[model samples]
Target: MLLLPLHSHGQFQTPLGVAQGQLPQFRAAPPNTPANEPIGGWRILPRLNVVETFSDNVRLQPEALQRSDFVTQINPGLVVTGVGTRYSVNIDYTMNNLIYANLSNFNRIRHQLNAMGTAELIKDFFFVDGRAVMTQQNATLFGAQGVNNINVTGNRQNVNIYNISPYIRYRFQDIATTELRYTRNMVSSSSNALFNSQADAYQASLNSGTAFSTVQWGFNYSHQAVHYERTNRTVEFERSIGNLRYMVTPRFGLTATGGYERNTFLSIRGSPSSPTWTVGFIWEPSQRTSIAFNAGQRFYGDTYSAVATHRTRMTVWDLNYDENITTFNQQAGMSGGFNIGNSLAQLMAAQNPSMSPEAIQQSAQALLGLGLQGSFFDPNNFFSNRLFLQKRLQASVAMNGIRNTFILRGFDMRRKAFSPEGVDSGLIGAGNAALLNNTRQTGVNALWSYRLSQLTRANIDLTYTRFAFLAVDRVDNLGLARVSLVRQLPQLLPNMIGMLEVRHNMRQSNQPGLSYHENAVVGTLSMSF
Candidate 1:
């Protein structure tokens, strides 16, 4: 109950050994859109980073007493990317070895790896995509940041995630289209035996290729099957939805959707079948702004979903809110960031069928800007884990200028267990009771990076998080702030960069003696070839 899941969408602070998987999405491209860029062939990047750090409180203990440590870290990494006319591949591997001068027992090595690729197996009719990630994760929700591996209070766990997806699409001459998709996702944890699970999902969809001047419609059906390794529990979900839309004008449209969902776990609550309906409006004031909102009644009482987005030459903003019932594993995935970068790349490829993967990546990065890239991965939960009922709201803002980039993100999520918590039966102490409980999480994160010169840059990051265990009446607050400066040292060595950083972190809780604070300074030298 003390663990806060890591954001799985990006490379930031992702522990060593985890591979990143690509979530599959099916959508028909607008007819006649042009491809965005040309393929750039294959390239490989190799780099090394060496860091030295000094900490006043290596163990993150309470202020009454403290321990100090000087640590050194060496990281080496390699990246390979392929951008072809019909496919793309990216692979990254890195290893970090930490050495603690005063505390040799705390030394360890961490490995991280991520690989992803897409292939047009049958020209324009069939495709395959796959990804793998191996990394480490924090075992607790609070305490020190996950990056510090020296004498840390938060237990560390090894995790591996991977997935493969294949899909087929067919278009009927400017009138209609159909798609079929299948994906398999697997998760395993070395420290937590109860979390090992495998999930398989299948989907089929059909939509109008060309909207009649006043109407457009679509139908979708999807099924998911899950299996837990240790508990031997199986879960299944089947859903079907149909959508109808009528355009009253060019700028506004009305939408109506109806669906039914069946869940094996939901049957425990008396009924496994849920009938749902929603009515909403779609508004597009301009090419740069759009909004969609809907309200409906479902198995869990009143339900609503809304999304709004606006984009300018230098700024991008998005807001979203949704409510749903899912499993605990799925709820964990839902709490993280989305993979907008991949969607953007796919859209670029669709618009420019001949563009190379490298070109598509470049164009997407340019379009979304560095601050917003990869921030849009899990919007509709098409690629998450288990089943639980949850209400969530998230918002993000990104702005890029000639010399500076900034990003701000905030989210609030509340979840309740759909099933009674499982009892440990014979277990003793705190382990005897059920672990899962209703909880709420709210947090805000902000990052800013400024280019001080052609070869120098500075950055700052700040985060605040609050966790509330409603059923347990426990709450905790955590804060982190970091500032760093990086300078490219091409004059001394090609592709070399030097950095200096300072960090301060604190955590407070209602429980006595459960709080701590720490300060650290670090210097690093990195080189790429």
Candidate 2:
């Protein structure tokens, strides 16, 4: 398996300042923070990114009208964070103003907000944690750069999602633990109202720390209800799991799990209740490597899950594979499954606050690119409301040396439709019908960053993606490349840092009338106080 690890300088604070996933197979344990850290303090970071570009094919099509203009983007952001012995909080907000020098009608402004924290209601007994975010995303699986012709009318379809989750956990000494959680997520689009939907999720879980010497166990039960506002359709799901693990050795363990699931909109032979089971192992050969593998029987037929992670002084790698059934709204909660590399990078930045913003941004983007993520603008691009079975394999690698950082990644995903759509085709919005069509997506991406000097750096990004629609017997291919150089100007101002960057981007597609090439140059300056 190939491992692609995205090492970057930031972590998002989810509900309770902890990452949350619906199933145990999807979640990873959080790292332990140092006990000597500050009890409570506040830090703020402000930033900006500006760019200018001239394109011969702004619409990105073979018949596109030739155009040239200066595109200026003003991005301002603020981050406030506080950490304490028993509590933590993070609030982030950003506003992006995009202006076209010649195409004034294409101007727009975007806003993003994220807030999350955890508080111990009682000393080591009760706790509360929650996270909330509002962000904009592209509606189509492929953004404007995909094989599909770009929507130049400025009637572009964009989706805005708002989600909030809160949970409380209680522990009964070393015997057992319990949690109650709730989540509310809503989605709206610019072009079509049919894509708008709301989802409310509830979950309760209990687990034993150690029933006996070297024995651990857990149980979880969850329910989710989703409603499509425009379609007037509602879907509900119920799931339960019981698992146990016995440690044969300090570094090796055996596990067994059994579960059952039922969905209102998903029926298998006129019955929605399906029993599942799995047997797996966990192995840790050394501090540098850990591995886990599982094989199971699921509703669709067979299922498997595997994860392997290795780390060295200057390199880190992660590989994972999983098969499951899910809905479109649920995918939003699991975009790039548990990015350990990103978490480490963020920890490093938090420990050392002197790192430049440009470097941090570069590392974040590199990590994101290295994830082999499908959608350029939508993190969860492979979305569908219909019940579908999906299999995913992904690998990530990140390496850092004295003056250079490299990232590479590749992923393949296949989705099979088990149920049909509830509404007519015309009423369905872009990307809403993706599950109904058997689809496979494979992509590879790479990034390199080299430090030219203490104040200058160069970077390059290359990516290729293939989309295959098996039900329709159609395939699309797209490729992108970008090169840029940045120089920091610190002596010119106080309590502020300014940087200048020049970049060129090119994109191409295999589809006729959707293929076009263009060039762009941009300059950006940012400040922090």
Candidate 3:
């Protein structure tokens, strides 16, 4: 089990698909609120949005059988935020009602929610964190992907995740700091209920205090047990580690770690219990640049991890690589990966240090409303039921200018099954388990945003992704492009915004019945009070 600190409102990593560049239909803050000052109590904002879309390939079918149609969407939403002495909360919920002109049978309503809260119960010793998320995702990478909930693709499925954690922290007199935490989490899917699961995790850690400046040491332990509803099976993971760090200089350090891990799973190899060890180094020459690299040995085999980051006045660069043994339920419930909204906000804040947090958040939301954000290439974990060994590499750079902003991101991910097949089935049946046994995905995304004026902005986004099934000798390539214009309607209403967008989507594949092309135009009007 990997123990990561839980945040109050961490960003959620979601999968990217064709035509995913559509703008979010909600505003960040109310018009009368002050950007520089924080709110004292809870404030609720209600909003309504109407969208009309026309697509030449509404069904994403081949050119010979393509059809066109109009999709009308009416969405009502709410946003709530609060900050108090000991607690803070944030919530966003939307109910979408869709009506299709030519495909009325496919019309449906969907719900979306993202909420999180944190409270300090004992001043400085005890704290609690909670989060709930309801969203849609593609059920399988082999199926046709939908851009949003409005699409009629059978691949779309609703996913719900809930987590709550409580922890205690204490300090020994000038010696060390200790923390103990317990977490409970649940994950469920509407269409793929066979993969539903619940897990309980416990963790404890102790680290040296300021007394040990040159030589620091730490101890950590974690345990987790997961229960699957369909299989009526339970899996357990336990790990313990002790680490030491010696500062060679003010800016460089050497580190060593030794650990033991045990797990209950059907491994193709021998028993999955082993002693783990790693040697690493950390370098931080300045506040704006840092790098960390580690090489380790685990039950699976050789393991490696690296993280490097650099920041400038107008640009930010990040690179990360890691190999781990994880399950879909754990990744969806706890892992905090790359999120475009949070990345944009960080870039904007870095570029304009004088801007307030609320101002930077609003600016990022405005850019997102103009379809200026690009999705990162995340690993596909939507259809897996067993544990897997995953290795992923990702890098991104963002640059902000007086009149333009640019973001570029690339990723490569590979996965191999560790648990035996046919024991439990995911969305894919046991007969077709080979598709998920060994897989790889590689992709790149680029986005450009230009400020036309104080009230209007233009954006261009491009993305390319490739999926490979190593066992089946199948591969697919998907490409997407979007151009959009957004403007604030202060003359019409103080809280209104309007947008127009055009998109193109195409897919090429070695597998039959998986190739298609689409063109779409969308117009939206949103108002909040």
Candidate 4:
């Protein structure tokens, strides 16, 4: 059946259909404090924000505590426009500091400055767009350890990322649009406590279509180079993605996607390639119900632990219902990946190692536990399909009217694991590490917002997630919970906007106080002309 998800947003007006344009973010903003800027010939926005946070969990739950953080930002941009002058430039500066009161003890100071520019050129109906940004992430954390787990030894990682890219596009008078783009990213985690990596990729593609009746097609080429000395490993990879979308009508659409990737091991690696293909459809039988189906195949190459190749097949289905302007979506699917190869036990026995009889038996047991292994992502997992419900309402407060919004999203999925031989020994190691026999996971996310006034607002966001999976013996379960509260003061003071936020995180496992928790507060003042 054909599916067309009914959306009140007047169809998907994604920016890819329009020229290059975006909003600005501060060059200097305290941690978790956001700075926004406009990218185009038009830049006119007044802004102010403040953020701060404190926590006392350090003594009770080291992992769940945050000592303090503060940030302040200020920025404005210049818009350049004309036939050949469709460019925008924005500049920002930031100052921030933090302290982590713990046995390891931590203190930090940061100063950042940034400049961003975007260009959109239209020549004789042909179009081209590009962006250039430069940033310096500098920080001084007392007594190094560079955010390390241990309390001793000082470690610091400094990174300077420079990004510059330009794309050329061709917009057919009445047919399609094609573009070519290139990007480079690198991070030098030289500090003893951090992981360093480097990567770069390029993409070339074409998109053809219009709403109601249209199609999209493209080919992408990319390369990823990475080195993690801390992990004692390296990987070199190349990947390609190609796909197409066909919209038969306003109420029905079909899409097909195909991709392939190959990775060469620099230190310890496995199969060099993986390929996947998928086709799906969307049908909107009525304004109240939506339906969808997808079928695909995936190959997950085994590197560290695999006796042979592993391939997975996937199938998915989804249904949705709406009433009173409220909508709900649900989905289900099945998928699995597996691989079989020569008996690993034979390989182990073939080797000659000097060891005691008991040691030999233990080693033999580890080999026998491997059996046939499987490794790959199950695309059919229900989590890929979710139900999101949302509504808008108006309210009255303190002599002024306000608007409120509410949203909820949920997902669940179960998957299989590879053989014990293919498992990473880290989590279970000497204690008995083996591939998961089966795994199940479920998650729910919620959001609520209230506009107290034209200049002041409040928001609450929360998420709850649970996990259940296989082990050599019985099933293991885990859960995570997170909550955040935010207050927006666009006019905390004239020409200044401030944002304050606090968050709490809890995880369920044998470990109670090892969960991640953070709190941040920041403020910004901006003046635009």
Candidate 5:
């Protein structure tokens, strides 16, 4: 399976580690640190890539004129393998640009460079495994000609960051495992490091499983303490799992599972964060068909809060079906199903405490005992539909063991936004905050792909969106597209890989005034000893 690990560098994607009733997969390629010692790894490979992009100079809209730009990127990477018994290492240095409308106008020049790696060591006995590891990432960003992009997320300025993490892990009889990790970030920007100082995160996990003649059961727990630049925030959640398995016969078996996670947010004096909940399910009918269902509630905070926690809830379902055309895994086919039940979000309204006594009282009371009834408990409902198909073929030509496969994916989503319209008015306007009625977004997407040879493959996918609301239009006619090719056969190249990839992104605004398109081409070359 292909693994794509994410860094904690500020992302909101929900993770299943705390829900599977199992240990988080503690597998990652480590970077070179503690210079003198040999940081073991599984295998080693170094890579370099270069790309150039040129946008077609076309008019965008009547109000928002058409514009075009050019960009170039250089990516260098290193991957390591075979560590303390078994482990891996990874490193990368990339140069790119940061361009946006609100920041530095259009086609802004930026340079970003990063060097990161990880190392792991482990020992086991009975049914338990003990491990220790460390990871480090250093990044530097510089703007064109030395001018920086004012946007916070822009790597366009003269900024540098170094993150260090050390962790320990233990597994009990393949049923459960836990980890103790500490992470520190050191950043130097145009301003003082006070805002760029160190922060830490604490995480705990537990999992267990029981297997009987015809049944299986499980449970899980996880909690994290996050502190950003000295602000302590508590994040805690737990998940439960239960499953039932049966064998109809020797060739086909069926298994079903149910999972749930509970999240809670405590209101601090400065800013209040809300708690949430999530539920999901998985069903495997046979070797060719599998399905999953997921529903969740999230959050959005009020003003004065640097972050908005939008409490949102929604349900989703998906199914996959595959058909083998050849006994040797030749011709094949697949179909899928998808659906979302509903969605809702909880919105917060902030009041200026410095206002007059009477004004403060009015605003405070209005936002306090606040309870608005609606279909989507939150301000919006995010829904989508999805389907896909796949096909595979064996070599029809040379004796070369080459094979090919293809896939197509389609998706659509609908969304609603209902936010407060501001407090009502009267002699002491203190209690009425109506919700938005005409705010919504919707869109569709299409994807296609092909894999050829024992080491090469390519694919292309695109999306179009439309919105019910003007500003939300782009959010509603368009998405992005990706096309890439990969080829790697170690026995033939002696630990070498050759790859080329291109991606095109296009979007049309719901308002018809805002649209964008971009193209990127990247080539890669790597070798290992």
Candidate 6:
């Protein structure tokens, strides 16, 4: 769901526009643009929020030990954005202070941040990208899951990730183009259960330019070294690949790639290094539809990837399937985080093809402010430090109407650890090693939003997730349903908003002492200046 801008080489580049879909949960979105905004090429907004919540089971514990509590939250936040001919940036930060009426000892403060930007150091050849994210994540899948920071489940931890990359590109007349890039990445966490890691990556690529019409060729090489602080070990990955593309027609192309990979890791199945090969095809029958599929072999076994996207006047559909061997740190740093705003913007753009980008962004922001989007479960990722082979398939459809919007998404993910499990063997200790050995996660989410009036809106969200531990014979099912109403308080103040929500959460587990249910109500008021 993270909105990553694609470059010509089919790689992610730092977006120079607004950061999509990274808004805070359970809060109002950024304020409307004021008349005096963007002073001196910069726009800044300061906001405050007050919230009150009543929950039957604040700790998500079983009925016998459940306790009722009233939670109060006071949050202050800021948003800053700027754009210049040579650079662009976006930053959003919030400080959450939670107070428990009955559980005073649990009062705490949490910081959340999502910032990214890009700059052109040299007009056409040099560029740099920077990003940082601080968010909360479930520490382990075996324990209770909390919907938000209000729950005292003791299963959540703060995770911080940072990345900086700078690259240079040059062209050789009309023959070819080449580029070299270096990236530094860091991942840290507040929990001792997860390891802190740093990585250095170097990459180089050369591709045929417009000189090659029927046949196009490319060569790429990359090397990465990651250091885990917890285990004081360094893992390295190196790859070299050559690829060719044959254009059969204006809308169809055949592709093939041959590569060799080398890695330093303890593998249980076979050698960690192997020769990789893949064959695939890309087809674009129309301007609104595209499909790509590839099948290959790696060290572990066979691998496959498929992507299909189609958009109509009022609807957008996407389906993807991919398999890869990676660690948790790598996934976190590479994908950034999911953004609902970005997804909404895409749907809106598809619905109104003539809308300008700036107008679409504003509309997306307004919809987000009205709480039309809800956080959905991501089955492809979880808390783990060991290296694993993951295969995931996800599909989604979004439809936009004159006064209503609907989104439905589903995903199936499977993971198996290939590295040894132990304190000295891998990133985690043996006690919790089995948790990630073999697992499957499947989930579906549906959201419906209705615009009752220009200033009022309503939303209903439902989600269900099932987690199965293949190695430990444990299965857990979680479900949530929520209904909310949001109103823009122009009468009170142009930049003020109010929301009321009611939700129910339940968990059904085959393991004893893990089943629970809770109902909650939340009211929030937000104002921006």
**TM-score leader:** 3
Q: What lDDT would each prediction earn against the true structure?
A: 0.63, 0.58, 0.74, 0.33, 0.30, 0.75
Ranking by TM-score: 3, 6, 1, 2, 4, 5
Model 5 has an lDDT value of: 0.30
lDDT of 5 by residue, 330-359 (tens): 100001112111100011011122222322
Candidate 4 local lDDT, 1-529, one digit each (tens): 0011100011100110001111011222223322222233233232222222333332213453434322222222322222226655544333333344343234544433344555665553333333232222112211111111111122223333344556677767546666776655444322333334444446677665453246656666666554443465555567677877687887687878789866654211224357866677766666534555556654432111111111111111221221110001011100112201121112222232332222222222221111101011111121101111111111111111124433344444444432232223432233432323344545554444455544444556565555444443333222222232222222442223333444443334433333433332322222322
TM-score of model 3 (CA atoms): 0.90
Poorest lDDT segment (10 consecutive residues) of candidate 5: 325-334
**What does candidate 1's lDDT look like per residue over 1-529, in tens digits?**
0011011112221111011121111122233433311236665555677778898887777888767889887877766777778998988777867798887887888777778899998998999988887665554443343444544554555567788899999998788899999988887655443356788999999998774557999999999888877665788888899999899998999999999988777333556568988999999999879999999977766789999887765666778888877753453322134433444444445444554455455434432321111112112121112345778888877665556656677888776656544422221113422223566778887777766766666778777877676777567777777787766565886445566778777778887886888888888776654
Better of 3 and 4 by TM-score: 3
Better of 2 and 6 by TM-score: 6
How far does residue 239 in candidate 5 sit from its true spot (Å)? Answer: 6.4
lDDT of 1 at 361: 52
Each prediction's TM-score against the native? 0.81, 0.81, 0.90, 0.48, 0.43, 0.89
lDDT by residue for model 2 over 335-390, one digit each (tens)? 24745456335433443355433234334544343212224322234335566677
Candidate 3 regions exceeding 4 Å error are: 1-40, 340-343, 365-377, 423-426
Best by lDDT: 6
* lDDT accuracy of residue 315 in candidate 5: 13
Q: Output the better candidate (1/2) by lDDT.
A: 1
Instruction: Give the range of the ten consecutive residues with the poorest summed lDDT in model 1.
Output: 1-10
